[model samples]
Target chain A: MKRTITLTVNNRPGVLNRITNLFSKRNYNIESITVGHSELEGVSRITCVVNVDNENIIEQITKQLNKQVDVLKVTDISDQAIVSRELALIKVLSTPNTRSEINALIEPFRATIVDIGKDSLVIQLTGESEKIEAFIELIKPYGIKELARTGTTAFLRGTQRTSNSTKNISIV
Target chain B: MLQETAFTKMKADNKPISGSELLLQALEKEQVEVIFGYPGGAVLPLYDKIYDSKILHVLPRHEQGGIHAAEGYARITGKPGVVIVTSGPGATNIVTGLTDAMMDSLPLVVFTGQVATGVIGSDAFQEADILGITTPITKYNYQVRNIEDIPYIVKEAFYIASSGRPGPVLIDIPKDIATAISEPPEEKEINIPGYQPTLQPNYLQIRKLTEAVSSAKKPVILAGAGVLHAKAAAELKQYAEQQQIPVVHTLLGLGGFPAEHDLSLGMAGMHGCYTANMALYEADLLINIGARFDDRLTGNLESFAPNATVAHVDIDPAEIGKNVPTEIPIVADAKEALKQLVAQEGKLPEHKEWLTQLQNWKKEYPYFYDNTSSLKPQKVLEMLFEKTKGEAIVVTDVGQHQMWAAQYYKFSKANRWVTSGGLGTMGFGLPASIGASFADRDACVLAILGDGGFQMSTQELAVIKEFNLPIKIIILNNMALGMVRQWQELFYEGRFSHSKNPVQPSFVKLAEAYDIKGYEINSVEEAETILNEVFSNNEPALLDFRVDPNENVYPMVPAGKGSHEMVGVKP
Candidate 1:
């Protein structure tokens, strides 16, 4: 199964290298990773989606990540109530006849046609990964010229902070 | 070089000192007494500072020897070993020692020099990615980019290296940083919010463990290096004796309990005694304190202690239920948990039947080898133990001789038996023994090495002679890698391959070359006389005993086999 893990690390030099080195050393397969400054000052949050075989691997990964010197916190919020989103810019071939049909298909999905070209239309979609996939499937018949995804990033739905332990002592 | 004199001139001025001065001050603050090192070009600044400081510096012939000697010092004194090495090969040389310390959980603080920060990635002379190479092997590592961060980083390195499940920590110092000007650090505890280790055990869990111990019909305590690291030997002994439980140790756990005590079952695992292995196999409750259940100790996981309800106590939470399932997992220091467990009331009756069964097995299947051959390795250790009256601090290199020493020499106290238990580094004994000797000059220190392993770091003999350390070095000349040769004989149709040593160096000549006392013995009759004379002299000496080359460590549990299926036991 694919799991999303968010790691809060101290904003210090060589931290990213350390995190990536740790993953490679432990043979953890990282599918995608997105890092940016978190709400906490002088700290960065890394959202990583990795492919793992079992729950035990996730536990080991989290424990190992917690052992890193710069990593302040690690949480596998994969099973929690989360708001997950992905952004994709997909270019699809649109003839004069198929342009209106494409508009009709993306009308309910709230996707926007960001660019119109002579040979194709570039559609920008930002939603849950499943919604993005649905939009792509509908537009596939029009022939996708190119596609780029920012990958899935997520956070808990409530005000619960990962740094503070919740009452739920789930999987230790 | 001028910075040292300037810092000394302005010592009372409250002026900012050079980075080297700050480094020395941090060492003084930590109360470090000794540093094992081999200086080089990149570390000249630190070396100059060291010369001005009051700390004792031990210069080994090689960088690897320096690290192992530091390890020896750490193991004996219960202090974090400190090392200073230059960049490139100097930093890379300590990899084996670092891995050994990491595997065995020894506390070490190593400082390595790097090229100037500007030239780090430019392929400058004597530059290497030391932090990158050592990240996985060390407990924690840091690269000192800013000279101002020196104090905080040093404090953090020491804290991490010596706290909860201690291991090696490395700090890479760029040349420019060390030469830059620095100021005195504020007197306060360095706050690292991410590094708090849990020391106290959960009382509820301790209660559960005590209950299980009280009700267990056949209980055994399997202690490991964690007991020694936590300084919990007293608590462990009391808990076992009060509960009338037999204690078996992992190889590294020797001396954690008195080996001669009736409740002690010696060591357990592949080359462990029959009594200890049998007790582990038959126990109804196994209380493992600080042991990680390494493959050598556990054998087949599915069949290991099948009848036991395990209660594992360790400082590292990741070790719990990692290899084997646990009924009660208490994440805490072994000493604290054992103290709490011992405080609980209720005197459990002695399991006389189980104890007698273990005794019978011990008498029936005792560790034995053919004694008809001349110069038996076990006989050599037995004689050494007799000569020393089991009162020496013995360090060993890895091989059959190491196992022989483990089985034959009785270590009655913790920290007295030092060996490379985890990484099994070949060149550990001589340097480590030299380090141990420095820890206590009055104590008899012995280095038990195989012929092949003794050659690996014999260069340290020069350092030993230079220091006039009265370390007795014994080389059991088996002329082959006995352990691997035995494995091939038993499991691989006896294809010796590279195990045999066709050509060998004359160790006595090497000792003579170093101007140390040297002796040679190849027959059983000469062992007592030679050992007695050499040991009585109380000087650094080497004795090469040409033991039976075909000797093998027996009472072996084939790899991945259950401890119950030990082979090579004689009637």
Candidate 2:
């Protein structure tokens, strides 16, 4: 099973090292992780995707992550209603002959041409992970020159919030 | 001229001092009385401050010895041990001790000096990436980059090291930070958001536990070091007696429950007693209080307590279901949980038939040894226990002798037995006993070792002689690594490899060289008189006993086998 976990941590030196060291030490498989500044000052939110076999392992990983001193809170939003997105840049090998065809193919997916080179066009897309995978498969026929992706970043849907939102903002 | 003017201006209003002095003040504020440390070039600044400070420093010959001594002190006194050393080699030497303390949950605060801040990543002289090396082993670690952060970092280090689920913490201080002069930082409250530990159990969970206890017929309580760490031995004893339940101890939990009690089942693990292991195998309700299900404690998890429902109580939430599938999980301090169970309104059902069955097993398969031929290690341990009246703080190095000591010594009080249970490090006994002796001057401290282990840290004998600590050292010289030899004989078809020691040193002569009293015993008949003389003397002494070389520790559970299928049980 795959789990999506969100963590609020102190924005300090080696905080990322500490979190990743914990994952490697405990033998947890990390699929992807994205870290950025949170809503609070001097605090960061880490959205991570991990693959484990059972619910018990997920619980164990959450508890272990919570043990780090810099980590403020850990929330497993895998089973909850979550709004998630991932940004990807795909450079497709193309010539002037297939440019219109490529533009027409990406129009329905709301992807835009961010860059155009002599023999390639870079398309930037933001959506759920599954949608990005489908887009890559559709454009594979044109030959992908290069690709880069920002791993999944997520939030709970509606009014539900993680425990850190209820904490005082001055703690960080 | 500008530098002098600025210095004078700073000293006029707010007094500024070096980071080393600030660290000393911080340690004094924490009520630290003694420190076990070794000095080097990287830590020269701190050592200069230590020279004028009032704190007493004990220098072991090696860095590893100092840390092990600190661990021993922590185990006996329930206080976090403090250690300081220099960079590179000095810092690397204490890695084993750090891992040992981490695995066994001993509280330790170790400070390691680093190269100058500018040269840290440039591979300058005596530089090591200690923080990266120790991240997995330490509960928490820090590196001081600024001089003003010294006071709070020291305070936080002590707090985190001694708090819930106690373990080792390390702080790496750069040379420039230690030498820099700055105004002392204001005292701040220690606030760590993610580090809060649950100290009290949920009332609903307590109610459920009591209900389970009331309905259990063949209940057993498995205790571990957490009981001792929480100082809840008395509470555990009361609950077990009130419920008429049998209690089995993990290796580190030997002294947490009285071995003389009628409901006591001594030590359940690989080398555990037959009755204790059998009770766990046949238990109907296994109420595990603070013991992690280590693989040695649970042989072949598929067959381990298959008939029982396990209820695990641990302070660390991560340990609850890591190895075994727990039916009831309580994350709280062991002492608090035990008190709640005792105070709950409930009466447990009587288990008369179960008690009888356990008693029969105890009588049928008691721990024994053949005493007709050669001197035996078990016999020597029995004599030591009788001589000390089971009151001494018994520490043993890792090997066959460690198992014998755990088996023969019946501890009736908490915090009286110390051994390297988790990491099983060699050469831990001698220095740890030296550390244990400092806990109380009047209490007798014993270091039981094997020939192979004693030589690993033999340099620590100088510390005993210099301090004149009243420590009794016993070396069971079998001329081989006894545990490995035994395994090779049974599992590897007697190949023996390099297990046998063809050459050895005269340990008694080595003790004499250190200006300590030394005695040697070669026969079983002379063992009693020699042991008597060594124990009665007030001075430190070492005893070398040449025991049988091929004798093996029995009542063994083969790897991947069930506990009930133990070999060497007397019919």
Candidate 3:
């Protein structure tokens, strides 16, 4: 199973390397990682998906991450009600004949046709990770000239926050 | 014109000293009396400043020795050990010590010099990415980019290293940063938003534990290094006595309570006494104070303390329920938790039958050895204790000697027994004893080493000679890696692959080469006389006791087996 661990860290140089290095050295296989600025200034939120066997792996990793000086907070929101998003851009071969059909396929998923060239059309989609995967599968037969993904970034639903002030979850 | 220029420079100096100078001032503020280090190109400026400063710098032959000595000082004195080493190899050399200290929870603040800031990432000559290398091994680490940040970083390093569940902290200072002009920050309270530790445990949990303690008929207390780190030995002993509970300690937690106390059950783990393991297994209530339930302590976790309702008290919240399931968890300092537990009044339950059962086990399976062998290692420890009357502070390197030291040498006082319990690093004893000697000038410090472990850091003999530290190094020469050899004998059909040392040096000559008196004893009679001479004369000496190479530590609970499943030494 894959678990998503969200961390709020000091927005400083080398914080990213410090975190990734821990994953590499400790042999935690990171499936995807996304980093961006958080609502709080001077703090960045990092969401990482790692392939793990059980909750014990998350507990160990979270404890190790919490020990890092640059890391402010670590929470495994995998079991929580979370709103997750991933963005991907796919360029599919088009003959001008298949372009309208591609547009129609993307329209139902709320995706957009951002670019059109004689050889191909570039489709941009932002949605839940599964939705992005489904859209990519729909366009794969048209020939994926190029592809890129933003990885998975997530936050808990509603007003629940993973903040420094929030009581730490017990190390279960 | 020359005088005017000199005066101008002097006036500028009054504004604030260079970063190196401010570092000295910070050390003074931390009241760091000694620093263990070796000089190098990157740290030349810091070294030069140290030369003119009041802080004593003891140069070791190797950087590893410096850090281990620092660890010894920290473990014995209950102070954060300080280390300063140059870049590249200097920084890399201390990795083992850093890892060892981290695993054992020894408090240390290490400062490693880096190449000038301009050449940092370019990988200039003698430059290493120390912060990157030490990230996982240290409790916390920093790279000082600005000279102004030196005071704060150093202060915070000390605070973090010495505070709750102490471990090593490092600051990688580039050369340019050290030479840049900067004033020491005002001595102010440090509040790291991300680093606050829970000092007070939940009182409701304590109340629950007190209720359990009052009703339990068979209760035992297990103490660990946390007791020493929190300086809670007195409180722990008080709680045990008031509750009339038998106290068993982990290896590193030996001295936290008197080994001679009737209620004390010596070291409960692999190579632990039979009675202690039995008590841990059969107890109805197990109170764990400041001890992580390490695999060694809680063998076969599913079956560990099967009959017990466990209440764990530790400072690190992450350690609770980490390895073993606990009915009640209290996150607080050992001293604070023990203090609270002591204050609670409850109807104390007496388990006279349980105590008597443990006594019978102890008497029947007392740690025994036949002195008729060439020179028994256990006999050496016994005589050392008899000669010193168990008054010396004994530090040990890992392997058979370390186990025998824990078993044979009784520590009746706190902070008297120090060893590499977690990492079990070889070659820790000699230099650590040097650090311990520095901590107490009048005390007799013994470094008990296995032949294999002694050779790893024997170069530290120079420190002993230079400082004339009253540290006695005893090498139990079995001519093999005794611990590994024992395992191979039992579990590997006696293949004995590479565990035995094919060739050995004369330890007496090695000690003599360093200008310290040396003795070699192959018999119990010789050991008794030589040990007495060294003790009475108060001279630093190394005694090589050649013991039976085939001897193995018994009352063994093999890895992953429950304490109740001990294989040797019948009760």
Candidate 4:
């Protein structure tokens, strides 16, 4: 099973290394990870997608991640109603003859041609991972010269928070 | 005049202190009385402060010995052990001891010197990324970036090490930080948001446990090191007696329950006794307190206590359902949980039939070995137990001799039996015993070692001689790596494969060179007399017993086999 776990951790040096080291030590396969500053000051939110066998393994992973000192909160948002998105920039081989065809194909998907080179077109797509995969598949015939993807980042669909308000909890 | 007045005012307000001096003050505030340490280049500043400090420092010949000694001190005193060592090799040397302490859940606060904050990543001389290396092994670790953070870091390190499920915590201090001067940070409550460990069990879960206990026809209590760590041995004994439940100990839990008690079914696991293993196999309910179901104890989880409903009570929530599927989970301190069980009102069923069955199994398959012909390692421990009356704090190195000691030398109280149960490090016994001897000067501390293991830390003999520690060092000389040899004999068709030590130094001569009394027992006939002569005085002594080379520990549940499928049981 594939699970997405979100963690709110202290914004300190080597925090990411500690989190990654934990996953590696437990032999958990990390499919993707995205980290950035959270809403709170001096705190960071990390969203990690891991491959595990069953719910028990995810439970173990969450418990282990929660054991790290810098990790303030761990929430398995896999089963929650989440609004998730991933941005990918694909530079595809294009000729003057096929530029119009690529633009017409991308317009329905809401993907924009951010940069147009003499021989290539860089398409910027921000959507669910499946949508990006489909867009890439359609453009594969035009030859994908380069591709860059920012791993999935997510949030709960409504006002429900993944972590409790940090007003009562000490940051350091 | 203005500069002089400002300096005087600053001194009156809050004096600036070097990081080393600040660390000493923090340690004093923590009420640390002793430190097991070895000095080195990176730690010179700290060592200079230690020279004037009131803390007693016992310097071992090596950093490994120092850390193991610290473990021994922690185990016996029920206090978090404190250790200080230098950078790179000095820090790396204690890696095995750190891992050992971590696995056994012993509380230790180890301070290692880093090269310098600027040179940490430059691969400077005597520099190592200790925090990176120890991240997996430590409960938590910190690299002090600011001199002002020393006091808080030290306080937090000790708190984290000693609280909840105790384990080793490391603090790496850079050289420049140690030498820098700064005003101490204001003291505050040590609060780690993610590190809150549950100390109280749910009342409903206690009700569930009591209900299961009252209804169980064949119930067994599996106790581990947590019982000792929580200082809940008395509560555990009280609960077991009140409920009439048979108790089985994990390897490290040997002393958590009195072995002489009728309800006590010695140790259970791969090398556990026949009765203990069988009781675990047949129990209808296994009330595991403070024990993680390690593979060695479970022996194929599918067949382990298959008929039982497991109620696991541990301080660490992760351990409850880690190796075994726990039915009723209570995440709390062992002492608190046991106290609640004792206080609960319930009509518990008398397991007379189960008790009788366990008693019969115990009598039929008691731990035995043929001591008629040659010197058996079991006889050595048995004789030691008889002579010491099971009062000595016995420490052991890993291998066959360790198993024999766990089997024959029964401990009646917690913290009496100390060994590297989790990591099974070979060189642990001698240094650990050195630490144990320091816990109480009058008490007899015994270090039992195998020939192969004895040589691993024999350099520590210098420490014994230097301190004149009254320790009884016994080396069971099988002339081989006994456990590996036994495994190879059983699983590899007698292919020795470098298991036998063909060349070895004379341990007696080695002891004599260190100015310690050394005795040799070549046969079973002289074992008692030699033991008497060694224990007759208070001076430190070493005994080399040339035991049978081919002896094997029996009642083993072979790897990947079920607990019920133990081989080598005398039927």
Model 3 pairs whose backbones collide: none
Residue A33 lDDT in candidate 3: 96
Native interface contact recovery, model 3: 0.40
lDDT of 4 by residue, A112-143 (tens): 99998899989999998889999989999999
Write down the lDDT of every candidate, Cα atoms only: 0.88, 0.90, 0.88, 0.91
* Candidate 2 C-alpha lDDT tens digits along A23-132: 99999999999999999999999999999998888999999998888899999998777999999999999999999999999999999999999999999999999999
Q: B108-152 in candidate 3: lDDT tens per residue?
A: 999999999988889799999998899888988999888777777
Give the winner by TM-score: 1 or 4: 4
Model 3, runs deviating above 4 Å: A24-27, A159-172, B1-14, B183-188
Q: Which of 2 and 4 is the better model by lDDT? A: 4
Error of 4 at A143 (Å): 0.8
Model 4 Cα interface RMS deviation (Å): 1.0
What is each candidate's fraction of native interface contacts (fnat)? 0.47, 0.80, 0.40, 0.80
Off by over 4 Å in 1: A91-105, A116-121, A133-146, A159-172, B1-12
Record all residue pairs in model 2 with backbone atoms less than 3 Å apart, i.e. clashing. Answer: none
- Point out the worst 10-residue segment of candidate 1 chain B by lDDT: B1-10
Q: On a 0 to 1 DockQ scale, where is model 3?
A: 0.45
Residue A20, candidate 4: C-alpha displacement in angstroms = 0.9
Pairwise DockQ winner, candidates 3 and 4? 4
Q: What is the docking quality class of candidate 3?
A: acceptable
